[model samples]
Structures are given as structure tokens and as C-alpha cells.
Target: MGVVDEAARLERAGYPVIHLEKGEPGLDTPAPVKQAAIEALLANKTRYSHSSGLPELRQAVCDYYASQYGVRIDPRRVVVNAGSSACLVEIFLALLSPGDEVVLPDPGYPAYPRFITAARGVPVQAGSAVTGYQHTAELVREHLTPRTKAILINFPNNPTGAVADAAQLAAFAELGPIVVSDEVYHGLEADGCHSRSILEFTDNAVVVGSFSKAYAMTGWRLGYLIVPEHMVTAVTRMHEDLFVGTNTFIQWAAITALGDAATIQRQVREELNTRRDCLLAELPRLGLQLAHQPRGAFYVLVRQWANTGTSAQLAADLLKHAHVAITPGSVFGPSGEGNIRFSLSAPADQIVVAMRRVEKFLVEHPALAPR
Candidate 1:
């Protein structure tokens, strides 16, 4: 966010900056989705609905999973909200007690720990460094302590796009702690890896999803959560107390947005894969090693930098000099210190140009070269 803010300051000062730090899909919301919202607005659907979500939209989400992945989820288990971040907070508040521990990936979404801490829970780090930057059952078991309350996992993960299959899901299910699965990037696979919901392996898992990435609806602020049958009411109550409800028309629009864009989604994913290919191929030539082949999401967390400077310093210098905004991986966690995350959400042409500028910048400042 600091990098984005700094870039914004430069942009406001008339400097042209290419942003590769944003988490969204960076595509315009689909035409049908926009039309749905407009229809809702014209129909005067602005009044607040249930704090959980519109019943139809919740049902649509269930139907989507059933058809897409054969993950048969009860509609009642789905709790719609403002976004996944909001759902994570509510889940944390409802499930965590002071001193309760949540085991999550180090170099994971930085927000996971913050959410746990917000609920007065202890955020325990399970380093993913040796597990190829993914939270395997081995890593989870290694970090398991008596205080463990939940295990948070994000596949097609941020920064590192590594994903786990059903085997990992089953492994997580066997653990006594509740599994918190962030599936926000569920449909954004750059590779052909099929992502299954934790619900497929464990009923005890809390599955989170969002329209922000798959449907290119970030501005819509629509997200949902699927909890075990018994936890729905508590999750709903906490969300109700905190947010009352989310956008009304947006909820109506999301019903249309869900499963409505197979072609658009495929095209977008293909484009992102192309971008990923470009970066993975070219970045290594620049002396940065990709932590792993990014199979999902639109980020490449480049480590083994040419420069001796810290990731934060590299990020800042690039923003200040090249007007290219990338994320310093240190902000993700201690394990992320030696790396920086580059987002591929920009236009293909712009990404090409930004890479060129980055190459030029590094050529002149040879000291920053990766060894």
C-alpha cells in the first residue's frame, strides 16, 4: 500500500507510473455485471437486505460451486459480505478468544496475522520457506502448538502462486484446528491446476471466496464465506454487528456476476498466463529467481535479486526512479525479506514497457544486479 501511495503521489505530480502492485484482476467489470447493477439500481434495490446477504445471491454461490467443482454446499452455509477481508475479520472475531492461536503461512497474506491480532488472538507463524513457499501438512504439524485454533491457507497464493491439491486439503482436515481457506483467487489459475474448496475435504473448514478476482469485480466489493453448518449463525451475527450489511445493488448484481462469464474469465486468465510467461522468462535473465513457477494468481515473487539492497529499498528505488510500482515482499512477512512481488494485472503492452524500463534502470545501476 505504501508503494501504491507513493506511486499515486508521483502520478498526481504528472509522472507516468505503471502499477504492478494491485491485487485485483485489473480488468473492467464484465458488461453483464454492470448491466445487472444498473438494473438493480433502476429497480430501486438500494435498501439494506439481510446482513448475511441476499438469499438469491447466496443460493447462486452455492449453485456455482455445485456446478463448477461439484462441491455441494448448502446455501445456508454461505454468508455474503462486503469482501473477503471483511469476512476474515468477522470470522476471526467470532472464532478467536484472547490468547487463542491461529497458525498461518509466513510470507502469507500480511492481513491474516493482522486479522488474528485484531481479534486479540496470537498469530503463530508456520514458515513456508522450506515447503516451497506453501503451507503443507508437514509445515502445519511442525508449527502446531497447544494454542492452535485455526490454520489459514491461501492457495494460488499472493506473491507466490503455488497451489495445493486435494491431498493437502485432506491433510489439513485431519488436523484438529479449524482450517481457514482463502479461495479468493479460485478461478485465476495461470496453469491448469484444478483448485478444490476445503469443503471438499473437510466440513470443518471455513471457505472464503470473492468476486474481486475471478469476475473482475473488485469495485463491487462483493465477497462471501462458507462455514460449517453450525457456525453460520455465529458468523452471521458477528458480521451483522460489525457491518450491518454490504452494498444492496451490488449484492443483486453479484447474482448475475456469478458463473456468468466463462469466456471472459478464460480470456483474462490466458492473458495473465501470457504475462506470467513473459516475467518468468525475462526476470530470470535479469538475475532474479522465481521462488516457484507461478501456477495461479498474477504475481511473481522474485528472490535472489541482482542487487544487495533490501526488498523494501529495491521497491522504493524502483518507484522513485523508474516509476514502476512493485511490492516489497518484506511487508508480507519475515520469510519474504529477500524478495519483491511483481503484480501482472497491468495491460500486456504496459507490462512489456515496464519490464523494459526496469531492465534499463538496472543496467545503469549495475550494483543492484542479482548475484
Candidate 2:
């Protein structure tokens, strides 16, 4: 957050900054979703609502799962919050205690460790990178300590864009730590790629999702969590304390958004696929190797195969001179130090221009470019 804040400040100061830093969606909120929110407000549905969110929205969420994934979900297991980021913090607070160690994938989401540390727990970095930026149950097992209380899993991951497979997810679930699965980017998968929910493997798992990416509702501040019946009450209390309740009208609107699955799914699938291809094709020419073709999400982790400077320096150089912004992998964790991440969340035309700028910048700055 601090790094991004600083970058944003510099950008506003007349610098020609092209920020590809955050994993934000480049698309606008679908018309149907925006319409629902407007209608809600016009109808005087602005009062404070239940802390756990509207019952109808919760049921709509359940119906969404059954229709989309063929998985049956009970409304009692769902808890809605202001955003998935908030829900993640609530889950960590409820499930962790002082001296407890939580296993998180190195080079994973930048916020996972921040939340874990806020809960007074230690974040144990498991071997996600040793296996190509992906985590397996065996990796979790190797890092397991008597005090290990929970495991954090994000897929299609943030910086690496690594998606988990069924066998790997199931195996991780069997390891006995409460799994906090972040599925915020589930719908943005690439060609021939599909995302699996951790719920399919175990009820012990907690699933966190958002309308921010798939629906292009960044300002709506809407996200939800799915947990077993036993954990719902505790999570609800944690949510209540943190955020008395979320935006009432937005909650009602999200129900409509969830019900109209076909429209939203089709749009996100098309746009993200196009952007992914644009980035994948152009990145190599900028002197970075793909390392892995991003099968899901809008990010790709690349570094100078010829070994230039650290990723942090590369990212700074790109933003300052090239007028393009990307996240340095070191911010994610130690394992990501050599890599930099680009978000395909930008428009295809903008991405093309950004790529051109990066290529030209690298060619000019031979000291920074790989030999």
C-alpha cells in the first residue's frame, strides 16, 4: 500500500506514469449491475440493514454457485462483506491467535501477510516458488509446525497468475489447517483454462470472492465468504465489529448481478483473454522471459533471462522513464525478488502502447536492459 501510494503521488505530479501496478479491472461495471444500484437508491432502500447482509442476496449467492458450478450451497454458510479484502482480514482475525503460524505461498498476494501480521500471527512462507510459483499439499506439510493454525491460498494467484489444480487443492485441504482460499480472480481465466473452488474439496475451507473483478464493480465494495455452519457465527461477529454493515443498496444490487450470470461471464471472459494474449506476446521482446504462460488472471511474472538488475529497480525504471508501471515482485515476498508483474487489466490498445514504450525504453537504457 505504501509503495503504491508513493507511486500514485508521483504520478499525480505531472510525471508521465503508465501504472500497470494494481490488479484492477480495466472494464467498467456492466450496465445491468449499475442499473440495479440506481434503482435500489431511487426506491428508498437506503437504510441500515443486517450485518450479515440481505437474506435474498445470500440466497442468490447460493443459487449462483448451483447454477454456475453444479455445487450446492446453503445460505447459512454465506457471509457478505464490504469487500473480499475485508472478509479476508475478518477470517484471519477469527481463526488465528497469538503465536499461531499461518502458511502462505511466497510470491503470493501482498495483503495476505499484512492481514496475518495484524492478527498477531507469524506468516510461514511455504515452498510455492520451488514448484514454479505453485503450492502443493506436500509443500504445506513440509512447513507444518505444531503451532501452524491456517493456510492461505490464492488462485489464479496475483503476481504469478498460477492456478491450482483439483488434486493439489484436495491434498492441501487434507492437511488439516483451515484453508483460506482467495478466488477473487476466478472468472478471468485464459484459453482452455478453468478455475476450481476449494469448496469442492472440503467444507473446512473458507472461500472468499468478489464482484470487483468479474463484474467490474470496484467502487461497489462488495465481496462474500463461504464457510461451514460452525464458523459463520464467529465470522459474522468479526465482520460486525470491523464493518457494522456494508452498503445496503449495493447488497441488493449484487443479487441482481449474481442472477444475470450469462451477460457478465461472457464479457469478462472475452476481454481478459484478449488482454492476456496482448501481454504474453509483447513481454518477451522487452527482455523478460514468461517463466510460465499465465493460464488464469491478468498478471504474468517475468524477469531478465539475461540477468539485469533486481525487479524493483526494473519496475522503478519502467515507471519513471518509460511512463509504464508494473509491480516489483519483491513486495510479494522474497521468492518474487527477481520478477516483475504486469496487469493485463488495461485496455488492449493501452497495453499495446505500454508494451511499445517498455521495448523502446529497454533498448535505450542498455545499462538497465539485459546484455
Candidate 3:
């Protein structure tokens, strides 16, 4: 089984199931963003936009990046899509041939490999969390083959909340291949946490971002991509055929979201930071080993009890017995087999309550703890 089915089956079995499995934002879309979409609908702007994107939204995307990152983005280089996942599909289609190989880090996003396979490209797992989930220049270089086409990076990463610093990013950027940087969790960093822009490192890269995390707009179905000038036409053309541009109404709201991000990000980041601190402090006491203090995003990747068997079985046992639900790290990749990921997107109170039950279960099932 697939990850989604495993989750659905467990949910149907009626566990208390403190859901830490999904990565969606816990908060509702801010009022102004909602209002903007509604107003756009009422204004009859609900028509097909330019296949690349609405010029207005594309410009907003460009302006947002230029002002925030001090990086100049030609509006022509921005391609709006339903989500960054779709953007990934477009890039793969535009760049890779049937036999091309793409390097993706292990314990990385599950969809990366699936998407590459769907696009008829090969996914080469090149990096490991054994080195703190850091994909070094040497490993990336070693993975390079004549067929290698791109390297994918997810910073302030999912399931681990780990962010790559400047030197690490530069190493990948300087590697002679297309770099796809997934920066979806950019603004949701814990206190004093910040992610370096891939734009700052190289021009031979595409940065994928969304309103999902920072603006609490997951269901908004909105994401955009930044491609280098040379690849912009190909990526945009693929999006044109496959996605037909992002929803016009959602684009309107996303523009408003970019404008109002300061107010929304401050409130969301503060809460996520608090939750991260609480979970990090408490999970270890319950006998799980925290691989590290995740400086950004909202996940805690913990080592499963040594003899507790597979990550999937341990996650199943946690849900069935302790009334908690978390993602089995194995779903990400082979290197993730002995770990599980807990999401802090839920409220702190719920996390605390869930931890209590987990602690009790660990005590009763002593074998689930490290020997």
C-alpha cells in the first residue's frame, strides 16, 4: 500500500486518532483572502485567464519576490498553477525525457518519485538523513550520470522541518544540473528561523512556492513557480496545456494574500513556533528520540522504538492503541524506515493530550522503547 490508503483505512477503523499525518495548515484562510476571492467571483472575473496566468497575479508574484528577497523576477518568468505539485509535473515534462534520471533525497517528499515515474523519468535517491538530511555536493556529484537531468530540494523540509543553510544550498546550486527547490514552507519558520532563497545562489534553478503554508490557504489550490529565462517558455507552455492556468478567482485571492502576508505570517509563525517547542520538549520524555531540533516547519522526526518493527507497524500500533496518528517515515523513502513524523499543525492542547496517551502506551508496551 500506498500512503493515502493506509491513512484512510486506519481512520475508518475508529481510533481517537490525533491526526498528525497530514501537512496542511491548521488555520483557516484569513478573512481578507477569502473576501478577495468572493469579490472576484461577484465581479464576473470568473473567466479563463491567460494560460500562463493572469498578468496581474503574475506581476504580484514577481513583485512579492523582488521586494521580499531582493531578487528581481520578470513577471514573464512566473507561471501560476493549481499547486506546486502541478508545477513539478510541468517541469518534469518540460525537461526530462523517458530515460532521464532525476536525483531526489531519501526521506524526501513521496510525490517526487511518483511524479517522476509518472512523467516517465527515473528518480535516483541520492541523499540521506544520516548526515542530518543534508544533501552534500559530493553525494550529488557522485549521483550524477550522463542521464541525470535535475536535483530536487525541499528546505524547511516536510517530516523533518530541516532547512539547508547558505553553504549547503550553494553546493547544490553549483552542481551542473537543473535545481528544483521546493520552498513551500518558507514563512512558517519557528522563532528566529529563516530560509535562504535559492534565487540567491543560482539562476539555473526553479523555485516552487505556495500560499498553502504561510497564508493558511491549503485548499486554495494556488501555487506558483519561478523559472530561469531560458526554461520559462517550456515550463509555461506545459502548464498551459496541462493546467490551463490557475483558477482566476483563486489567483485574485492569492494576490491579496501576498499583499497581506505580513499580518498573517506573524500570527501563524508565532503559534507554530510555540507548538514546535512544546512537542520537542515533551516527545523525548515519552521515550522517543528526537533526531534533532527542527529549526523550521512543523514536524518532529523521531526514531521509532528499536525493536518496535517497521515504521508502518509502529505508526499503526500508535493509532490503534494510543489513539494517535502520525506518518510512518518509511512512506518518504527507504532511509526513513526506522522513524515516524509528528505534525505540530494541530493545536498545542491536542498535541499535549495526545502525548499523554502516547506516554502511557510507551510505558505499557515497554518493547516499543529503545532497548
Error of 2 at 346 (Å): 1.6
**Segments of candidate 1 deviating more than 4 angstroms:** 304-307
Best by TM-score: 1
All candidates' TM-scores? 0.96, 0.95, 0.95
Q: What does candidate 2's lDDT look like per residue over 99-143, in tens digits?
A: 899999888887888899898989998755677777677888999
lDDT of 3 by residue, 251-323 (tens): 9998899888888988888988888888887866877787656878788888887888899988878877887
At residue 248, what lDDT does model 1 achieve?
91
Ranking the candidates on TM-score from highest down gives 1, 3, 2
Return whichever of 1 and 2 wins on lDDT: 1
Candidate 1, residue 248: Cα displacement in angstroms equals: 1.7
lDDT of 1 by residue, 261-284 (tens): 567668778888888887777775
Identify the superior model by lDDT, candidate 1 or candidate 3: 1
Model 2 TM-score relative to the real fold: 0.95
